[model samples]
Target: MLAPTGWSGRFWARTECSFDGAGKGSCTTGDCGTGGMECKGNGAAPPATLAEFTLAGPASAKDYYDVSLVDGYNLPMMVDARGGAGGCASTGCVADLSRRCPSELRVGDACRSACEAFGKPEFCCSGAYANPTTCRPSVYSQMFKSACPQSYSYAFDDSTSTFTCSGADYTITFCPESAPR
Candidate 1:
């Protein structure tokens, strides 16, 4: 369960994982580097799709969230904020990015973000291009955005990527079905 205050974290899935009878195993993608199934206060490895959330804090009553491909993408995911203020809605990337991922960014079954694939200041939005004004989306980021419009393809994509809610519960799903027409 998530708290109404002082809570901030991310959620993601690990793929191609195999656990032994004693719960010891590893994953090909999004590994937490714990050498076990349990994360145990560890963060996921690169090439992961992240659903990040910052719950309502003392200064605000709104909950902010976003599905980000900034680190990369290992699986399709969705986040639905139900019964909240500020037009809370569903946002995610349902596309199978691994299929269309650029050859250079392809890492096994996952798609690596341009910043991860190419550690350049421009692609990473670092150094001189650290600010939003200078860090515009590159061609690689645009490709990710095109495939997943509701997700953060890179840093400084908050304008259209970030979302908010209040007094609501969230539903996160992996490989969610298509919405009814």
Candidate 2:
């Protein structure tokens, strides 16, 4: 698919899906709740791995991307940048968080973030804990960071999690080490 210049969007894969001829179905993980193959502009449910992007725009003049587990984690993913300048580094989370998932955060093949599991302001980085200073990483977020150093473990994990590039193409690979070629 050719994304026009300045296009911005996110992508993810749904696991354990079942669809009929009419294209209606649900997935065990990353279900957008649209009840169909197409998400129809709907976002994925929690515990779904995501590859987010904001292509070069007038305001920034550079592309930004990240693999975020702030919502949760369902699988391993990696983002590679090709032919770009200005910190065009590869970034992603290739760690299988499911095996290391805490008991409280485990959801079948997925792992819920602290915010998704408890909805606490501290975990969600909301209210008084909206900023980086007030919302230090919790034990749960710390664990995620320790496992997936390149992923956005919490809401304020910007310095390392977010990456930038200019005039580059990106490849988002799910389960990068083992995905079918």
Candidate 3:
């Protein structure tokens, strides 16, 4: 996708898909509910890995991007930013969380986020914990962070998780083999 300057959106991959010749089918995971191969502006289902981006907006020259596991992880993904300023680099998770996911949070081969697994205020960062000052990462979120330091493990992980670049093109790879060691 050719994202224009100032564009902000997310990218993700669908797994276990089975579409016919007419581009009609369903995916066991990350099914965007569009009833076809194209999502048509629809969002993916839960248990999907995400790569979020915000191109150089009007107010700032820096573009921002990150891989997110806040909705839990369904696949390995990475984001590589090149030809930009501020030392743009690659970030994401190569490790498969499915095998290590806690039993309660496991849904088939995907791992569910803590908020999805337990819908509690603390886990969801809602109610009293809605603000960044009050909200904090849970043990489960920590597990994800431990495995993927450059990615967002929870809602308020912006300080360490978000990356910045100026005038850079991005390559988001699913099931990437070159994830950082």
Candidate 4:
């Protein structure tokens, strides 16, 4: 069994069929075949002329969010969310989205909104999610130093962890990859 990281499935390898008589049905992501198996140049390379499996390396960080990726895997999800890959950690933690949002937003105004969805950022470093600054109240920093000491990034694009201030709506893509289908 394979574990989840972030890669989509392997591209379907094409197979070489001979027009040596009987017609068989075949097609790729794009063009559909004619009376016989027509390799209609579907953009991707055709199938292998031989039978073999090419094991690729681990899935990249983005693939996990695509519909085609993580197709076969039974993911761990929030109990109530059901087969839908529940919770932000499971289904909502993607990086790319079909839509783009402003890199920054004011705390009170609505920033990025997709349909009915809205992104209101939160300082993950608050309270239990924050750290103690003991002898230091670095006025230079609004964020309590040593707070959220570990989780501060979404690795793929290497962007900073977004935050929304009190009484503000921050502009951020609502999810990791995209909106829930």
lDDT scores for all predictions? 0.90, 0.89, 0.89, 0.22
**Model 1 TM-score, all chains together:** 0.94
Using lDDT as the measure, name the better of candidate 1 and candidate 4: 1
Which consecutive 10 residues in model 4 have the weakest lDDT in total? Answer: 70-79
Rank ordering of all candidates by lDDT, starting from the highest? 1, 3, 2, 4
TM for every model, in the order presented, reads 0.94, 0.94, 0.94, 0.16
Clashing pairs in 4: 6-64, 14-47, 15-47, 94-176, 94-177, 95-176, 107-168, 107-169, 108-168
Instruction: Name the lDDT of candidate 1.
Output: 0.90
For residue 1, model 1's alpha carbon misses the true position, in angstroms, by 3.0
Q: For candidate 4, write residues 54-95 as lDDT tens digits.
A: 122253211112111111111111101122221212212232
Give candidate 1's error at residue 38 in angstroms. 1.2
Q: Please say which candidate is ahead in lDDT: 3 or 4.
A: 3
Task: Give the per-residue lDDT of model 3 (tens digit) for 69-153.
Answer: 9988999998998888898989998988887899999999999898988899999899999999999999999999998888899
lDDT of 4: 0.22
| Model 2 TM-score, 2 decimals | 0.94
> Cα miss at 55, model 1 (Å)?
0.4
Regarding TM-score, does 1 or 4 come out ahead?
A: 1
